[model samples]
Target: MPILKFPPIESADEQGIVAIGGDLHVESLKLAYKKGIFPWPISEDYPLAWFSPNPRAVFDLNNIHIPKKLKKFINNCSYKITYNTAFERVIRKARDIHQNSIHGTWITEEVIAAYIQLFREGHAYSVEVWEDKELIGGLYGVCFGKFINGESMFHIKDNASKIALLSILSNIKRADIKYFDTQMITNVTGSLGAIEIERPDFLDYVANTTAEKEINFQNFSLHLDFDL
Candidate 1:
């Protein structure tokens, strides 16, 4: 285990990057989450950079809005969704597809290994969207009590990522999740009903919920989550 420490998020300069170059041990990742900070490597060759952005983006579970067209698409699609199934594949694919669409991927082999450890520890999970036995799209993230903080997602076809998102949101209610932290706001997430709040507000939100009080949820209501 590495002896890692972070400056208060308030100490972040305009860029929101708080620290760099800590091993991604499970404890360090957990501590980062607890502090509302996350790792996003600027480039594959760059050292790890931790960020806790201001104007933090999050989804209000009570107000997660699925566009009517996406709702119709999900209702009409032949996708089979499952939880904690193919966790590695989901993360791998998310890394692949996301890297293609954007520059600088943080999902290095080391990141995969660390998150796999977290998954084995039951602190991280994934949502897979399968079509006819083919895994098309999915997303992965860490979950704390009342919150499932999404990390990355990818899609092979149109609306596949949306399907994965809707699936997780629909089912998380079973785990009693009230928030979905997007980490940052983008046009893609903004379209899916993610709204930004202050960073301090987000810190306060997670402070009230911890692993001691929340358990990994199972058996979700798929139909209900898509409706939200």
Candidate 2:
């Protein structure tokens, strides 16, 4: 059976490895996210690892910064953005993109299978950008209670993922969820307003945040506004 609990968040090393050697079963994943942790497979040496990083990277919904040029492009773009659609396709594309990149990839077949199960269980979702009815760019993540932890994103065209991110942020803000966890900062996310907060503050936020009913991303549609 998958372990239902993990080590105390404070026990994590400077690298933020709270625990190692747990299966990515839905029950375990759900518990990990509740305590502000998530899985990261480091290498073949470690089957699976759980992490809760200090100075957690996150986006403040009220302060998301979109470049002016990107905003203009977003306003004029013909792409269609949809939520909870083509999730498998999105993650697979993200995997392929990573696998071919210089950085390699962490989304192994095992990881994909596990997250696909999570998606089926309604704890994960994808936001896709379609152009000419062809999938071009997208992102995926796990959502529990009011917390959304972005996993990865891919784009076949310029600024496509940015559009999807802005759309999700707008909708999430409207739903009253004020933060989006990015785990670690990347150039893409950092340029888009992801900031770091102390681990304890992040845990406290997660502890106080909960939703009796899940936000239905399926009913969500794209908003054309670029003022976000």
Candidate 3:
């Protein structure tokens, strides 16, 4: 397949949609992510959409805020955390949770398959939370060097997803990454210290921060005893 090319980020409209109707081939996905763009399908009726949202949301890794209650839950929970152990499972669970919501979801079969391929190729990672033998919550995202674009997360038990996030943050922090891209901010993320920055600033940060050095997700798992 020929390479897919994206327009300049400045060309995006007020909505941050850079393009529409592209195949989710792994190569296309790679190029899009590397350029700080990502796919978000509007619906079955519309073709796939790519976004490089202005005022991008990210976690300033050095300053993530843990609500007092969430911090207490983290210190008390018995959930075990793993990295890159069940990536497809995490993505599918996120899909199911979003599909059942009134707002619907963009995690179509195409998106799932593409991301699974990315995971297999080592460009994506997952943080999974489990209770004994049962999986409860997790998150998955694409990673480029030290920059991680967190795609989605879901929880089956109370605060399970948050736990998964904190676990991943702690691990990534130890790796020396300074930012965690949450894409668009929601109340949940905002409450956890997500902040918005101009798209140009975000792109600049991505360009300068990424390196040839890759993170060994397989070697990184959450330690139950954490400081947050």
Candidate 4:
């Protein structure tokens, strides 16, 4: 399959369906994200569709709400969260859990390979959870500029995914990142502080936040103490 090149996304209101066919190759994936594009298909056999949706769902890095109960769980839970420790395992778990969801998953094997390649290049990252040395949950995503576009999350234990999310958000805040793109809104993300903005508003935020700074993936670290 050939690599795809998308046209200029129409308008912020058009939901940014830039292209509809492509191979999920590493170079293509990096190019897509640098331009604010991402691949999402219904199944492995479907042509890969790229999008930069209008009204993107986002979380302000400093505003990620840790519900009182979740905070309590984090305070007392013995689970530990780490970054980039198990990227392949995290994606596999996300794919498995997504297959059980109503919307199914667009994370095809090709998609997996592309992201793992990004992981190796320091553009993609995973937040992993460990409980007594057992992997319990995690999330993965691509980072560019001041934004980390969250792709998906999954848990094998109660509240484990939330812990990973909280840890990621805390790290972003510590690093003074400004935006966290959730891609789309879902009840799960909403409960964790994600909110939808009009397309214009989202682009405005992205422009303002990313204008003066570049996000350096190599500098990101997840080892800081989380106060939550």
Candidate 1 residue lDDT tens string, 42-98 = 776778889988878888778877777877776677877777889999999878776
What tens-digit string does per-residue lDDT give for candidate 4 at 81-155? 778889999999999998888988888887788899888877788989998989999999987556577788899
RMSD of each: 1.9, 1.3, 1.3, 2.8
**TM-score for each prediction?**
0.92, 0.96, 0.96, 0.86
Each model's lDDT comes to 0.79, 0.86, 0.86, 0.76
In model 4, which range of ten residues has the least summed lDDT? 219-228
After superposition, candidate 3 runs with Cα above 4 Å error: 1-3
In angstroms, give how far residue 196 of model 3 lies from its true place: 0.5
Screening candidate 3 with a backbone cut-off below 3 angstroms (N, C-alpha, C), the clashing residue pairs are: none
Residue 43 Cα positional deviation in candidate 3, in Å, after optimal superposition? 1.0
In model 4, the clashing pairs are none
Candidate 2: clashing pairs of residues: none
lDDT tens string, model 3, 65-159? 98889878877888989888899999999999999999998899988999999988888999999999899999999988887878999999999
The residue pairs that clash in candidate 1, if any, are 170-225
